[model samples]
Target: MHIPDGYLSPQTAGGLWALMVPVWYAAGYKVKKTLSARQAPLVAIAAAFSFVIMMFNLPLPGGTTGHAVGGTIIAIIIGPWAAVIAISVSLTIQALFFGDGGILALGANCFNIGFVLPVTGYYTYRLLSRGAAEDSPRRWFAAGIGAYVGLNLAALITAVEFGLQGDLFKAADGSALYSPYGLSTAIPAMMIPHMAVVGVIEAVMTSLIFVFLLRNNPSLLHSYDGIRAAATGRLQLKPLLIGMALLLVCVPLGLLATGSAWGEWGAEEIQADVGYVPQGMDRYLGRWSGILPDYAFPAAEEADTGEEPAGAVSLEGVKESVPGYMVSGVVGLALVGGLAWFSTRLLTRRSRKKEQLD
Candidate 1:
């Protein structure tokens, strides 16, 4: 869940930011000690995968939408420490470029989707598949189950954050200062769709990719049973790259999703829903409008005509958006993946340096 700006009070957002700075540092140090030079670039691919997979939105029960985060899969392939950096790269790009999430809420978003999902999934897989052979079915499918668990857990944590905002913060008349949804509404609204639909897609996607790589290019993955790493074959990047290209082509499919995600409604939406926009949201929302707002090209203002009718979908808007969505996917992939590659490459290089005192 991409928590927009103003959804949480400044205190909550700042607290999460404080929590993540050290976690991000620790993740980098751990990855530096373990990630080899050859393995670093694959983190880029995994980061790009995380970026693109998030574009495919599936409808939820309450008219909201959800999508799979490839966090668990990335963790499985490159360890949770590296997965943190990889997925963080994707989330940062989405927030900064696409306005998918708020700038102030970036830390909270990363903590939930980037940190919690991967670490939980990675450890869960390790626990379930412990002592199992590399090729064993239990080990093979354990990642899928881990992904399911991890996705739901992340979703629940997001719900709690949204839920708490309403209860803890209020205006003079007791209207919500931030999000209007308390635990009673936020919990069910966010959890039902995630548990039923989104988790299945996450599990299946993770397992199928795991199965394929384990069979064909096991070396691409972080040592599962210490067997895949020692296997004879490695370096089959073509198929994976091809798959990425295919995903970019289909990224526009995300637009089919009809509604904003739960708790992610904008100021206008909040006004319509609750008859008043939360004062905090009115203040801090849209502090940073992204370069490509909503993954669409800025529409050319019509010839002095008044704004189009509310809720009206124009054919031209669709045509313009599809290409913009496709371009946004490419831009996101390049930016996210490039940052991952460079950062990890620098870390890996630093790890290899020997201090020689003259």
Candidate 2:
């Protein structure tokens, strides 16, 4: 759902950017008010986790893939505004380094996934979990459902933005055109499959994590419900560690299961159900460039080992090149995790020493 450059008209992109300015400011203000000294470390960890999670795209049915943005996780730990900042930074890094998303499309992506999902999810969870115990099954369930709702909502927002862009500049009808990418189309295209399965997976994962925190370090979660406060328990590190281990082990199995199904379905389902057939935008879209020379396929030097062109992107290439991806995944995870831990330790230790001296 990361809108690439040229998918949106200049006007649409500019409009979103304008809207984002106030939102970003609001998010910053909220962060200043909400984030405490103790919660700071967790906030950094949330950002790092989000960054790492998105690197692995889960296969969908249409050859296109989706990744966990972890907006809900961030919202759960911090407020939505902080989630926006974290996601924005993570997305910016992804855009800059890997060319996963276009820099020109940054505002739109931030608005849709970062702002829309986390803000809405946090509020919705707050509403549903009202009066529920923090560690209760109900609160966890609400979080899961809230996350699902948030993801679908973000998808809907993206679809509408795309549809509007498709119509505003692509169609002769100056008014909004009736297309498959409309709200109706977007709802089913993005909601149906995600709700059925992805929602459940997210719910289970979120619940497990929530429960782990509840049983272990209750102080880690500042805003737990009233009932949870009653259960004054000592922090148990072993359960949390074991739970995390289980999650790590299960991630691959979940990825394989969802990835295969989603990869097969995404192409046909989206092309058919959410097809935004912009009749006259190809010429315009093709001419646009981004931070990368060409968003779709930026030119790159040859591998120098008698390898294929670096810029070439093909479905067959992906299918035939599973091993390369596996290796990349291993290497990328190690690099990201090492960087996150090292940076966190260095920064925190420096800050702590400064505080002690003061």
Candidate 3:
């Protein structure tokens, strides 16, 4: 779930950043030490997958929409450290470029999806898959179960973040200054769809992908140096590239999703739904104008014709939104994949230099 701006107090967001900075640093160090040339491309591909997978939003029964983070699958395929970096990069791009998540809330979003999801999912997978053969059905079951649990846990953490804003911050009139929903409202609103639907999707995706890799290119799967590697041989990129191409073709499905996330509504939308917008939210929300708000280009023709504002494009049933989303997906994948690949190349060079010195 992407918490938009004005959903969390500055204190909450800042605190999450303080917590995440060290985690990010540690993960980077670990990745530098463990990532090999053969594994680097896998990380880049996984990063691209993480970037693109979020484009396929699924409408929930309750009128809202959700999507799998792909964090657990990445963690199972690579390692948790690399998963953290990949997801953090993807979330940052979504926030800074696409306005999918709040810029101020980037830390919280990364913590939830990047850190919490992967670490929890990876550990759960290890625990359940232990003592089982690499290609055994038990390993697949473990991946599914781990993904289900990990996604739900991330949802729970997100609910707590929203709930805390209500509990800890309020206006002079007792109106919530940040997120209006308390624990009672936030927990159910976030948990239901994630646990019942989103988690299932995550589980199935993780298991299926893991199974495919095991059958076709098991060597590409990171074993955490035998701790988690499923199969061993040489790295393969064809399957991953093919999977990404298929996902890119399906990016437009996200536009078909019905409603926004529970806590991601803008101030005006919140007012329309609840009859009163939180004063703090109304004042602070729209702090940043992204290059592509909601992955749609500004309808310049509509603006020139006085049909709508320059940046206003209806999210519902718009034929033009498809091309815009497709472009966003492809561009995001390229940026993230290139960054990951470059970073790994640098790391590989440094490692080689160190070995020479030794």
Q: Which candidate is the best by lDDT?
A: 1
Output the better candidate (2/3) by lDDT: 3
Instruction: Estimate TM-scores for all models.
Output: 0.92, 0.68, 0.91
* Residue-wise C-alpha lDDT for candidate 3, range 37-118, written one tens digit per residue: 5566778888889888888888887677899988887987778998998889888888888888888889999999999999
Clashes of 1: 0
Write down the lDDT that model 2 would get: 0.56
Q: Stretches of candidate 2 above 4 Å error? A: 171-187, 225-358
lDDT at 271, model 3: 86
Strongest candidate by TM-score: 1
Stretches of candidate 3 exceeding 4 Å from the true structure: 224-234, 300-316, 352-358
Q: After superposition, how far is residue 31 of candidate 1 from its true place, in Å?
A: 0.7
Clashes of 3: 2
- Per-residue lDDT of 74 in model 1: 87
Supply the global lDDT for candidate 3: 0.82
Candidate 3 lands at a TM-score of: 0.91
User: How does model 2 score by TM-score?
Assistant: 0.68
Candidate 2 per-residue lDDT over residues 1-358, each given as its tens digit: 6665555666777788888999988876665555433344445556656665564455554444566666775687656776787777666655654454556677888898789888877777788888887667777777777777787788777777765543455355553322224455555655665666555555566666666666766555535631123223333335433543443433333223223222112233434544543433332332333333211123221222234442334444444344433433344334444443443344345444544666
lDDT leaderboard ranking: 1, 3, 2
Q: Which runs of model 1 end up more than 4 angstroms from their true locations?
A: 225-234, 300-317, 351-358
Deviation in angstroms for 93 in model 1? 0.7
